[model samples]
Target: MGKMIVRLWRRGFLSALNRGGDPHISDEDLTARARHLAARRHLVAEDGQTELTHALATGLHAATELLEEAGLSRRDARDRAGVAFLKSGQNLARWSMRLWLWVTPDPVGHAKAGNKLAERARMAWGSGLTVHQENGPDHATLMVTECVFVDYFWDAGRSDLTPILCAWDAQWMEIVNASDRPVSISRSGTLAQGCEACDFCFKRKAKLVYSAPFWDRLRGPGHGHG
Candidate 1:
């Protein structure tokens, strides 16, 4: 799983970097280098969580270093690298959103799916991740009051890196919005934005009614009410 992640990340990162005219090594070569860095930093643990999290951090950190060598500032390096990383994972991220749309098929069910994924994250990272969940018949909100990656990058004096992590969550929300599905997801804040928690707000889109006024009829079907 660790190596698999590195491969995907390198694919995205390399693609983005190359598009900017900053050449990158092949994915196979980059992946090998990143895995070595993770191992050297003692970030790979037997249970695999360390590799799952820190190993990617290790790769991103390397990307920053490489970009810095190409004349980018530390902040610029981090922002660019983070963007590349997010770009790399978009397809995989869409799968879950698509799955939820297929499985839940309603606003309430969508909210439940979001709640469950938050709970799953809580279990995956233990203290590193924290989820404060709220669910209703038509809406659900999952807030992350604490996050390991936010704390980690901040402690490393690179709080800028945290937003890249936040963008991953953003991708999921964006996917739902792009779909014609009646359910939509949103967020008002993230720990990266100095909020107390990152909010994942999912609500059912209002369905259009045919029996409404003529003006409403011209407007046709819509996401009902927000």
Candidate 2:
């Protein structure tokens, strides 16, 4: 898990740094920063959530610092860092969903596989994520009472970044459940936003006229019929 966080942080941090347009950040500096992050393997939280939260926060902080050094104001630096973090999360989710689809072959199966893996991970890491699932004919509702990410970030006094992390849940769901029926995730409350719990409602909406397969959509035009 520590190694995984290090790898994720390295990917996000380097991607953000390269795109941040900071003249002072060189190849040598990048290597040094990677080393610095890797050396903090001891910072891995018992629940695994704080480890990832800290890693993402570190990446955002690095981006904000670089942008600030490049003459951006605090607000501008944070905004840019947020964009970079969001892009990194989306890229990671897309890659993960593709890999899951390759293994599971069907979207529903892929989603179930992912849910099982996530549940196992939470149990293994003692993440304390509580959920209630309701299955319907065409949709499912998952209500989460406790989230490790929210708990960790709030405890670490970095609650400001929790929303950024929470945003990845929707991004991942969209990627994994991409379908003609408009699979959607709706959340009303989150622990990060001072709510008691997070309510994730995943539902399949009406089908679209021009819905395309996930792979075709991912590959863009010229690969599938319009």
Tell me each candidate's TM-score. Answer: 0.75, 0.62
lDDT of 2 at 81: 67
What's the lDDT for candidate 1? 0.68
Clashing pairs in 2: none
Clash count of each predicted structure: 4, 0
Q: List model 1 lDDT by residue over 1-226, tens digit each.
A: 6557645656666887556555454566556666676666555354455545665565676677677777888877777787788877788788966776654536456447647757766655655667878887778787788886786667656677777888877898898888766767788888888888888877766665112333344667893232
Number of the top TM-score candidate: 1
Runs with alpha carbons beyond 4 Å of true place in candidate 1:
23-46, 113-115, 123-127, 209-226
- Tens digit of lDDT per residue, candidate 2, span 153-216? 5654556656776776778767645634335566778877787767665555554532556666
- CA-lDDT, candidates in order: 0.68, 0.59
